[model samples]
Target: MIRRLAAFARPFSAWLAASAALRVLHLALGIAILTVAARALAAGADAVATAGTIVVLAAAKGTAHYGEQYLGHRVAFTVLARLRTDFFDALARQAPGVLHRHRSGDLAARATADVNRVEVFYAHTIAPALAAVVVALGSAGYLAAAAHPALAVISLAGAAVSGLAVPLLGRRPVRQAARRRQETRGLIAAHVADTVGGLRDLALLGAAGRWERRLGALEERAAGDTRALAARLAIRRAANTAVLAATVSAVAVAGACLWRDGQLDRQSWWAAIAVTLAMAPALTAVEAFAGESGTTVAAARRIFEIIDVPRPRVPPPPAPAPPGPSGSAPPRPAPPARAATTGPATTTGPTIIGPTIIGPTVIGPTVTGAASPAAAERRAAAVSARGVGFAYPGSPPVLAGVDLDLPPGSTTAVLGATGSGKSSLGYLLAAVLTPTHGTITLDGADLRDLPEDLIRRRVALADQRPFVFSDTIAGNLRLADPGADEDLLWHVLETVDLAEAVRALPGRLRTRLAEHGADLSGGELQRLSLAQALLRRPALLICDEVTGQLDAATEARLLDRLRRDSAGRTTVWITHRPATLRAVDQVVVLDAGRVTTPAGPRLSRAGAARPGLSPAGSPGPASLGDTPGPRGPAG
Candidate 1:
């Protein structure tokens, strides 16, 4: 895992090398100052000369120290920024599917707090560890040449004990404590997010006290982990101090014995002591950073866990077959001519793929000429599911062997009670969740084979509970269409019947919403989410109980608008409400993860029934007034 993290710093290798070199230079200067002063004192050299030499070395040491700090932090912050980008990109590749399996607060903690913790490894650990090794060895070798070989042996032993053995021995317990603390922190963040997001509901249900107690328990666990980590760190510090004191005293006593035995001169004795003391700073630094390693390693593991999850790689669409192996491209066939009255209108402005619908409300718009290739594909995207099946990990299957077809420009209603897989089916059709069995297709091409951007652009799903960022109303709506003007924003809002309510606000489009749109009522929040989705003008719009929060009158109005403006668009309404089926052209019932057609009059296209549409069961022209659903009748 440490090796993997080092790869992220590859782009900043030059900075790292410079930082490490400066650090080594700084420590070397400190050792030089000590050696110079010790030898001068033993020889009774000129005071002026010794002081001058020491002062110059100290000045140089300070400069190197500054440079090392600057470069170390530069590399750390830059690498951190890159890590965040890569983390988000990885999450996006596996999104909706992967997102469902993780807590939002835990994900947020990994991205923010966990990533921040890894900064210690880059800023303090790497270069200091490198410099410590270089300085320790240099000091030992110099002592051997300038003093007795026995003195060098004694110095090396002390350096090794203080720098290597003590640190390595204590690392395991420190790391275990750090890991526990990090996990507890993630849980606390998750609980806080859940509590805050559902605070209104909790208050209404009088569960706030229960939530508070749970939070208190998590805080207690986090506090316990923190205390354990602090205790281990305190013990390690005491051990390092003890080792340092013992090593210095042993070196001094050994040098004194050598001098007394006439095996060392006074100058040689002082030089040996100076070199031995020089090893202290480097070895002590190694010990200090070792304590920090436990926390850094734990945080890094958390970050990599998310990045390493398996994500589907959607290949780019195949190039246009290499121009058919000719010098010039082959002549393209012209589209078939249609009756003048039946032909769709053309526009010089932006090509609208289909009518814009928010939730179950629609804002009318028609396609135009000079369309991009992607736009042309979106104009008539037919979808089909063949024996689709899905199940969450460690849970029973949510959907199974379901077959359904949504013809271009058609509206279908999927009616099922809670836990009947209506939302799961919608997710599969919208390409947010991949089917574990069989296939789902868009325009005869398998959805799994298509690029993510193409799927996102052509299909839009207005979730029953959509996320709203803490931003102005216009800002939230602009997420779907950043270039949408005030006129367009108001138009979509009006279509969803949210314009009047918004206008009554003090800031109107500029009004800032609380996190999760906490300030707004449920119906307003849903309409705002719907308006945002409508800005995409997708060919296929999937609404998963988007109108569930609205009253019957508002739901009726929204559905009426959807029926009027949903021309030339494929719409799927996922709801348990039977009255909502009035605006749909056909209805399919999902029960126990299976799709079966109900015995009712179904709307027919051009007064004709589609054959071979199995899994949809018997086809018929359903009367608009009939109340059809899973409990109404069986095929």
Candidate 2:
């Protein structure tokens, strides 16, 4: 934890240095005030003279302290904000790999609860801890200047105890407290998120009351942990206070003895009192360090765990990508889809290789009846993955050994039972999950060796039960293409057959899609997901069981559009039903995580074979069963 904390702070050394300087100035002002007060008291000073000096000293010290607070907090908060940014961005980029291994609530706890704990260390603990040392040394110097050099040693000993000893004594208990708090918070988040996500399931089963009782018990455990920590915290405070009182009493007795022996003067006598008073604030400040000590440890461990997550192999930079016509290639395997290997590769000036440019256009020999323009366009082939394998962090291999190649300009259907690693295959081929054991390539080139941002613009997936932001349809699409014009946006909407529905809405392009898209029907939500995938215009499109709940007609319409728009593109559709598979060019079957042979059907020239059933005795091809039905995975 400390190592990671050091790493977070490493980038802001300048701010730390400035904060330290302010702390020194602030301490100096405080010491000056203490010295003036002691001198006035020791010299049989006049009431008015003493009052004036003390007031001026208090004002100067207070201003310095205020400046120190502002500067230290500002710098710490800025660093903390940056740390939060780094943490969140890294988590976003890292989530694809980590999600399979971790629970959503657990991750949230780390990102939010754990990161917030570091603030205490930055805002309160660090500067004062350093300032405590400076004040102790400065007080000793002040005492030495006042006639008793030995008193400086006495002050140093007390400051050292408060700065170092107190925290060390509390370390074990504090660490345990922090770990308990962190773990409890994660458990609570996990339970709550699980309950909320599966609300429909619980309600349907009449298990809602049971789940609440269960989650209530977990919440009580978390609260109990807090109570336990508070109890220990109080004990630590008592111990620290007792030691402080003892130290002060001993010092006072020593001062009196020194004065009796004539070794200490009136100045030394009064200085002792002022120095001892400073010890209380300095000692009270140490408690902050002890308190946050546990949280910092927890946060550091959480952060380190995230950083250790494995990332997909980054693809090499595209070789000075060719600037094809329109700087956009057709969705076929050779050109536009190569961009999907990483994403759409961008080129500034005219070049040789471009993502959007349609590869060499073939002119077929024309008989009296040649292929229609739409058929010929649909004939454009897209990229395919031959063999893929993957495994989550703790689980056994997800895709043990799977071999399948997706054809260009065709929708390929994949089916399997739950936990058979169906979704894992979609993510792997889409470059969202890097195969641990096998290679995945686009246009016959390895995907891991491609630039990532380029992949997002070219290859994309709409997940099962997709999330919709509380924003307009246009706002949602803008996330895919930030500069998407209203015309292009509407065209994509119409392409997905949502134009009628979108137009009927009160605000149309400006209408808000309420949170979770609760207002939209399952069919509309599925179509909306389709519209999103269309907006990307990706060379390769991955739909992971996203259409498992719509009515047959709606499903048919959506699948038909998917097939139509798939022209010049490669499409992979994960499903359990055989009906949807009938429209696609080929079908891949996964059983226990391995691919079966003889790609199901070649729907290119001929129509769907064997009605609704896939060629291999699979269920109806268009199973929208994955549409978050009664079985929401039960967490």
Candidate 3:
């Protein structure tokens, strides 16, 4: 971690060097001022010359101090900016899967507080350590040159003890305290963020008081950790101060004895005393920074933990076929032609491939020896999961051998009880989660082989509880399609039955939303999410209980609009709502990590009787067994 931090500092090497140089100059000036003042007082030197020299040295010290501070902080903040950018980029790569192992609040603290703490490594730790070395060595050399080799030895030894030995006295305890302090801080930050986000829900459940007590307990624990750390630091500071005083007093007394023995003149005696005092500042700086070193190390380790997460591998594109003999281009063989598909979509089970033409599209780079564009467009995005399985780390499998097929242009509804893997299946189909045991193919091509950006563009998933940024309605819409204009935004809003409400807002599309759409009602928030997904016009749209918060009338109207608008698009509606099931072409039921046969009656596009089902029957396969009543699906 230290080596990695050093690399980040490389970009600001020039500024750091300048700051170190200025710091050395500042210390040198202080030494010169003290020596000159001592010489003037002992010999009763010319008053005007003495005062002018003292004034000049003081001014130079002040100037160097200013330059050092300016350059040091400039380097610190610049390095911080780069560190934050890299941290966020690494976090983004691990998101939604690898990051699920960490709490959102803990991750947030890492991004903000942890990154801020790293500034000290560059600003206080590295620069000061360098300057201390220079000041210490220069002071020792000055003492030797002044005809006091004995004093020089004493000064160097004192410098070593102060810089090196003093900091090591309580190393283990100080380090432990620092780690505990930072950990407690992160916990407090995470808890506060979670409480704020769910304050309303807690209030409704009459559990707000309990949560408040929990937060207070966390805060008290953090404060206790901080106080413990402070007490340890105070002890260290007192020990360092005593060491500095003893070293300086011993050197001063040794210089006086040498002067009395006729080994040194008056000027030399005063100069030696002044030089001894000069070493105090350099030693003190090192001792003080040692305490902070523990905190810096702990913070850096936390940051690297996130950055070191392994990124998903993307396969290299296949190399073009070797040139034919004689340097002449060989005629390429025509790709296999697929039969045109029509009628209502159907599935045999979770693993069976439906009779739909799966082909690639132009959203991603076309692979060599692939089907032609015209043929690909004629085919729908046929998704199939063959023995697909997934489970969170250290947990039993949530989805096992989940074989299923989604025909092109088919509207399929996934129905299951809570914890039956409905949303997990949706994530798998949308390419958000990779199958652990089997293969998921997009148009006969392994989804993993496709570029992530291409999959995101072609497959849109509207989460049950969508996240809305604190931006205008138009701004949120632009997140799906950046170049979409006002007309396009209004069109998607109208499709989700949210146009009229938005139009009545003070600024219409431009009216800014509070954090996470706090200003909008629950139904409005869901509709807004749908509108954003609709704007993308994705090839596959996965709605994971998108209408769970809407009223029956609004839900029916939105479903009708979705069925009409997504005419040729493959729609995976992950819902248990019977009203939503009426609009889909077919329904697949899941039970305990397996795909069960649908027990609901199959309905036509008009929700009327199908050829194989009884009239007024629920729509689906018989394997689902004992479908719920016609009122609506439960949570």
Candidate 4:
């Protein structure tokens, strides 16, 4: 695990090596100054000369120390920045999908706190550990040659006790405590974020106090973990100090015995003691790192967990087949009238690729003999689905073997009971979720083959709950098309029946909205989302219950505007309301994971009753009269 974390530092190898070298220089210089000063004093050397030498060594040591710190921090901060970027990139690769499994607070904690904690390894641990080992061995070797071999053993013993033994003794317990502390901190962060985001809802439900108490409990657990870790660290410090004292006492006694035996001179005896004292600073530095190692490792593990997530891969486009004898490509087979429902499906056409684009587009070959001249002029892309199925991770299938063939410039409504996968279908169509089985084609091209930017530019989805940034009205709309001008903005707003509402505001288009559009009514917020989507002039527009919050009059007016906009674009409305049915040209009903319609003959014109949808008179399994509940995993 440590080796894996260290790999991230490979890009900064030069800086790391320089930092470690400076640290070793700083320690060696300090040892040299002490030994020279002690020997000079014992030999009654010139005080001025010794003082000058000491001053020079001290200056060099100070410079080395500064360089070590500068290089260490520079490398640490740069790695931190890169780690943050990689983390977000990982999130983007699996998003909307991963968001269902991970909490916002936990992810935020990993990004901010965990990544910051790993800095300890770079700025504090690496160089100091290297320096301690090098200085300790050098000091022991010097004592063996210049003073007494026995004294060398004492020096090495002291260094080992302070730098290695004490840390190893407490490693397991300290590590466990550190891991617990990190987990607790993540939970606390998640709780705090959840509390703040839903404060209003909690208050209205009279559960604010309960939520506050829960937060307090989480904070208490974190504090307890921290205290456990600190206790282990305190014990290590006490043990290190006792070991140092014992080594020093043994060194003093052995040196006196050697002097009595005429094996050591006064000058050398003093120098040996100075050498033993020099190991104190380096050993103590090592011990500090030991106490922090547990925390550092725990933090690094969390960071790597995110960084190692595999990014979604886009498959290579299908290979084109050789032309037939007539010098023309053979006609592709038509999709199955109804999708098969056994375990895995047999693909009779193009191989299916799951959610590969950032957004959705309906493209490819035109529906032959179906699109009229007026509809063809609209330049809308044809959307078809053959045996498409979808399921959330570890959940039941939401959509299975569902077939759709929406012609260009047509309006279709998809209706389903709660958990019937209405929203899931919309998301699949938008390329936000991947299908578990079957292919979804835009024109003739598989959605997986289209570039992300092209799909985003051509497709738009306006759902019931749309995120609104805290910015001016015009600023928010510009997110859809950054280059959209004021006139075009107003025109799209008018298309969504929101122009008059904006004019009534004090700041008009410039009026700032609170986060998530909290300042606006639900209907206005829905309209705002619709307006943004319309501004894109997408080839295919998907509105998932966008008018659920509006009054009948507003919805009526908005639908009227949508009909005008629909003249030149494909539209899909996913809803359960009977009223929504009146605005659509055809209706498709989903039950359990299959598409079913009242017995009817397939029609030829775009938006006419087809194999996938029931005609106006026949009722599907889920009648419009059924009361709609909260959407499920299928949704």
Which scores higher on lDDT, 3 or 4? 4
| Of 2 and 3, the candidate ranking higher by lDDT | 3
Against the unseen true structure, what C-alpha lDDT does each candidate score? Answer: 0.73, 0.64, 0.72, 0.75
Q: How many residue pairs clash in each candidate?
A: 5, 34, 15, 8
Q: Which stretches of candidate 4 lie over 4 Å from their true place?
A: 311-384, 406-410, 439-458, 535-540, 563-570, 577-586, 598-633
Q: Report the C-alpha lDDT of model 3 over 519-558, residue by residue, as the tens digit.
A: 9988798888888887777778889888767777788677
Ranking by lDDT: 4, 1, 3, 2
Greater TM-score among 3 and 4 belongs to 3
TM for candidate 4 is: 0.79
Error of 4 at 327 (Å): 41
Worst 10 residues of 3 by lDDT: 355-364
TM per model?
A: 0.80, 0.81, 0.80, 0.79
Candidate 1 residue lDDT tens string, 1-635: 78887888888888988999999999999889988999999999999999999999999999999999999999999999988887897787666666667898988998999999988878887888899888878888887888888877887888888888888876788899899999999999999999978988999999999999999999999999899988988887788888878877887888899999999899888877787777788887887778878888899988888788653433333233333332323122211211112243222111111111112212223323322344445464688776677776566678866666677866677765556687788888888777777788998999988888998878888887788999999999999999999988987887788999999999999999998798998888888878887778788889887876777678767775555445445788876554454455456666567654333333232122222121122222332112243321111
What is the TM-score (0 to 1) of candidate 3?
A: 0.80
What residue pairs are clashing in model 1?
Answer: 601-621, 601-622, 602-621, 602-622, 603-622
